[model samples]
Target: MTTPGARAEAGTTRFTVRSPRAEAVWLCLFAGEAETRHAMERSGSDWTITLPGDLSGTLYGYRAAGPWAPEEGCWFDPAKLLVDPYAVELDRRFVQSPLLATFGEDTGGIVPRAVVPAPLAPLPPEQPRFARGGLVYELNVRGFTMLHPDVPEALRGTVAALAHPAVLAHLSRLNVTAVELMPIVAWVDERHLPPLGLVNSWGYNPVAMMALDPGLCPGGVAELRRTVEALHAAGIGVVLDLVFNHSGESDVHGGILSLRGLDDAMYARAPEPDGRLINDTGCGNTLDFANPAVRRLAIDTMRHFVTHCGVDGFRFDLAPILARGPGFDPAAPIFAEIGADPLLADRVLIAEPWDIGPGGYQLGAFPPNWLEWNDRFRDDVRRFWKGDGSIGVLATRLAGSTDIFGPQRVGEGCRSINFIAAHDGFTLADMVAYAERHNWANGENNRDGHGENFSWNNGVEGPSNDAAIIAARRRDLKALLGTLFASAGTIMLTAGDEFGRTQQGNNNAYCQDNAIGWVDWNARDLALEEHVIALSAARAGNLRTFAQFPDPVVWQSRDGKAMTVEDWERPGADWLRCSAPGTGFGFTIDRAERSVNIDS
Candidate 1:
């Protein structure tokens, strides 16, 4: 196979590919009304082809002829057209199409031919100014305003909706200082979803770390810039949830996406003991940060976000995986460099400090200046207030979890990111409404979500007209919010938790891209929204109360009893009065007031 008049030159428009294992490869191009098949030339393990003019907006795929063997991770069937991992533009949105197949031998033999367009436009200027001590609301873009009737139908799913007056009004009223939009980077549905008639809603499986998903940015970079500027004008910051721990491309058996094609050796492969790919992320393959080239790629991606997207911060998904080598170490070179980098050092760096890898739990081990998602705080507070445990764990968590975070690195004066629920799991409403996970919609039976929810259904599995259960659920929600705000650390709230959004007991609603996960603006409970607003107001009114440095909060129980270590361990002591010595305010709570007291 050979491409006629194909040559490599500085200004020449030609693409090259090489697969020693393939007998032939063809470049299939959608040129006007007809499909043109051009044979590609092979050089060693590479193949080459060239187009006469710009191929912008032209649909293209590749065909490679080779044997198919399912067991050994080689499924090369040239009959299927492969998407280019580095294609800057996509011709179609990802619909549930079986026509898109993953099984192909010589998968790397084909590439999505790059579409030539006018010279790429320069990115928007960065907005570096951000308000200090701002409350950040973590939300899924599609879930935040997608179902709201107030948002224009065309703008609902795109970045344009974020700037709509209705959306801005909601954020302004809630007094959110920042809106940490979940991963909006270009991503793909997990391979299992299309076959199951499901779609990826979380955007965690990113294919391109630098580019925003076109589907979400219909108006492109200009629209995203407007949204960011709108947020900034309203005194709010914008943070992005980034997933550099791995790519959408799974193991060798997965699709041939970006990183896998640019350089596979840069990724972490199973060690010499097995020589397979390490599956630390549970999503199939773990990125090999051990390789310098991979490290550079990750750093470059971060630079792109900071330099181009104007993001004020980044919340790293599966951050612990980024610090792992043959063993887990908090002081890994990659993390240390990031902390020292002038561009990223001062930016808000939050880590989801655990992965499925060995010794993956590094809860409080992240370096100074880095905030970690306090899962321990989330679990303990839930259990204690829900009447399941001694208050000892809650006491430790409220003080920033010195036990798990270790007194050495994260003393009583460090800031921890505390939250009860995030986008990955159940909403606050479902936490108290279901004991068992109802993830049947995910097509993996009921095994797709975590089995141990540490949740109590309050005597009902889901929605109920019973007054007692409803009241208890509401109180619990308030309590959870209160506890998060009162804790001696930074607090974060899931977007719809304030108004009581429920996934109907589904803890893992990652693939339900519809109403199950979206916020219902029409059905929002005004009273509850007010309660959440009041909580935010209280926090804003008394920032000193939650601050950790300078002095620790001193408390005394109502019966003239000091809150000793033993008092925390005691299971029967429900009503206790706590006082912040330095801040002049004291509050008391039995089990019922825990919701409002802590949140407010």
Candidate 2:
């Protein structure tokens, strides 16, 4: 198949786009305020135009003409500026407007233009820097460095900020194997957010798959490539968190941004009678993986990052949607397709592993080579620390979730990315500081985030002035962090979690791009940060032992007696220690004192 999007040649550039249902497609180029629309010739399902002169850095977009039936999934309005699906750079960020939805309203003034990318020599294929069963640090690029004082003011809140010495030192201190960056791709604010004076802090609502968001990554692909190279120099890998299940174009009432205007069939639809768009991702519309064209786009997007940016791997948000052909198929063709692609075959693949669709909760359903975000580990660990969970269940999770991933465990290479908290939920500090979610600021009447967080405030609900309450919260935080570091698997630590960063109890601060969302580096808990540093160093030194639950292990009581099944199953059993010979490691969890002692 011919590569889609603009390709610069010796003296001319060839532009291609796939709009099978469109009767006609035109390539619109921008020079200053003037725009030129060149009609493209159709060959099969694709539209092409070979323009005179190398058009690198030129601003361009597409306008397709076709049927406008939204119900049957044919949205092609020439007035709507369509971003190239394979675009790697954009002149500006996306914004929401009602004009984007109204037919023939002319969104040329509102929509962003895709920039013709300069040709880059692909990186020599090398083994990924990330290793299995290593610490995966998750972070939002903008939020992570937005308020960092050490980062230059000019570079704050951008991908370039990640290459700062301060940021590198922090990641190195955590002994991070890979930094799983949250969505950095171009995304538009949700329609409801502008009215509320809020913006999407999380880039989950993506528009173009390959284009980097200008706000977050001002230098485009070059900025990302530079950052990745710097991180590699620091012995840290880079994994992008990509959203393939849905697009920011949203539902029928939403905008005709890119694929929707070019090829509406790019989205999955319900069985004919009504033919409504599938809402599997709960992000309005689900990208149709069943369509071969869509699969090609997904694969091509992965290749672009790996070849151009030299990223170690990707973490698929709402990954179950990748396998859904209306129903979840364990043997989805995408799994085999990615495995077969040479550029992506060795790249680390992590899956969120669930969506809102039927059978979406496919915990251990991904291919063996892929690592899955273990939400079970999050909830069960939270439950145990909250004091209502079973020790046996906690033990299973700490032992690598053998029930979910099959018995060939972490000792061999665990498939679980264990975490007690992630970006979607409460921060690790809030888990012990706020019993209930305080998301009143999200403008959804305090009802936007998860209600049952399995959280427990020590004494007071929000902040506390009492020294005892403060001490207790710190102890609980240490216990939780210790449990995570001691767990058997590739553990993940969300940025700012090493120190104590809070959203003022906002479990879902996805829209708070301000101080409420930014990490308060000035007010960080230094002691907690040091504790995490120690844990990270110990985990790195004893990685072989910490990667899996030790065999020939003895579960002992506080008195050092081998614990019986009765002791293991005892209700309110809070303390236990485990040790194995020759591994040079042992650990004790004493929930009564809110502490975890790691000996390695």
Residue runs of model 1 more than 4 Å from their true location after superposition: 1-89, 94-134, 406-413, 544-550, 592-595, 598-600
lDDT for each candidate structure: 0.70, 0.92
Whole-structure CA lDDT of model 1 = 0.70
Query: TM-score for model 1?
Result: 0.84
In the range 128-179, model 2's lDDT, one tens digit per residue, is 9987667999999989998999999999999999999999999998899999
TM-score of every candidate: 0.84, 0.99
Badly placed stretches (over 4 Å) of model 2 are 409-411
Model 1: per-residue lDDT, tens digit, 484-507? 766766778888888988888888
Measured on C-alpha atoms, candidate 2 has an lDDT of 0.92
Q: Alpha carbon lDDT of residue 7, candidate 1?
A: 33
Q: List the residue pairs that clash in candidate 2.
A: none
